[model samples]
Target: MKTLLMGTAVLAVTASTAFAAGHSVVRLGTEGAYPPYNYLDDAGEVAGFERELGDELCARAEMTCEWVTNDWDSIIPNLVSGNYDAIIAGMSITDEREEVVDFTQNYTPPSPSAYVAMSEDADIAGGVIAAQTGTIQAAHVAESGATLLEYPTPDETIAAVMSGEADAVMADKDFLIPLVEENSGMVFVGDDVPLGGGIGMAFRESDPEMREAFDSAIQTMKDDGTLNEMIVKWLGEDSPRF
Candidate 1:
């Protein structure tokens, strides 16, 4: 997960207004930085697992959708303020978050968080750890014995480890796997930590109908096996499904 301020302000539109009649335009918000989940393509448009999955869900729900990018930290706040309809970012479903926004049935199963360091000998439990701010990994580190260093972006969390500002970086195993493979200096350390329930789309509390529509669309994908195919395609064949 990551956060960055959008260059322009988006017109506020509630799900009730935008998604009227279960077949109207609904703006989908995401952090265009988390790869294999959501990220910006070379064309500067949002791409990755979320983009393809969101588009399919929109079509299945008979709704027109537009993508919007928002800072991850302010994503929930902006959703509450009506800047967008639903958040399709790789957001974890948690009681703490549900108290503020409503979540659809989970699209992805629970993922494990892992640590990456320059050496296998790194002290994953007691050493300083870097994590993207506002993410479940960050919360886990804050509670763990390790010193927690928070960053605004996933890249920065990796940077903190590369620069030795922190002994290791903690993030979703899916996100860290490719990075670890590409970087000769980085290696996974510590046991994989499972946190949060699963990933889901988030809507305002007042938009129960809108949430239900997408939830049904998600279930359709699961039933047809399309969701699992997509998950394996982007998140590796070993990724948890359903």
Candidate 2:
């Protein structure tokens, strides 16, 4: 009976260790409003480049990942609070953000962010440009002579330009390219100043192990053509720095 009890205790310890090792779920967060990065599809499902990329990364890492959506402004704070493990939003690796959270190596390369005007005759060469609120692009627009009108989302920015409420809307090159292609009246006059290198996954400074895992997964995706394929699918062949 003593030997049997000892054997049962050993088995229980082994089972507990296995359970701990198997708990490999990583919670990823994103702003569901950003298209080509992450967005809600017509079917109300989370879909977009970042969503696909996250799914692929989790698969490669042999871990389960759960995606949660939140307002763009709240993403970083939520990450800091441990509400999620990482942010796959198209958030740029800016110096200001670096003060708050650690970022993985950029998966997407640096691309010019620009303003597009809805009016063919709108002279944006020396006019006002608008950008989404609280973004690096907004800072760039403010520097220009154009008065910056900050919106909460890209859709609002686009609407402002479309309705003549704003002279132009500023956003990433890849994001504006598709909008220009689809809308005949809109034109991308010139490239705005480059903001930063590129968008990266962000993690809290406290979670070094999670950050390392995410960085490793992103590098693997980049080396194996996964990242390139995703870029092409979402941003087209002319996408900068594919």
The best candidate by lDDT is 1
Tens-digit lDDT track for model 2 on 122-198? 65656666787778888877776777788888899999888888888888877787788898998977645688869
Which number leads on TM-score? 1
Where is the poorest 10-residue window by lDDT in model 1?
A: 1-10
Q: Compared with the true structure, what per-residue lDDT tens digits does model 1 show for residues 1-242?
A: 22232321223333475456444888899999999899999999999999999999999998888999998989999898778889999999999999999999999999898999999999888999999999999999999998999999889999999999999999999999999989999999979999999999999887888999999999999999999999999999889997
What are the C-alpha RMSDs, in order, of all predicted structures?
Answer: 4.7, 9.2
What C-alpha lDDT, on a 0 to 100 scale, does residue 134 get in candidate 2? Answer: 74
Please, what's the RMSD in Å of model 1? 4.7
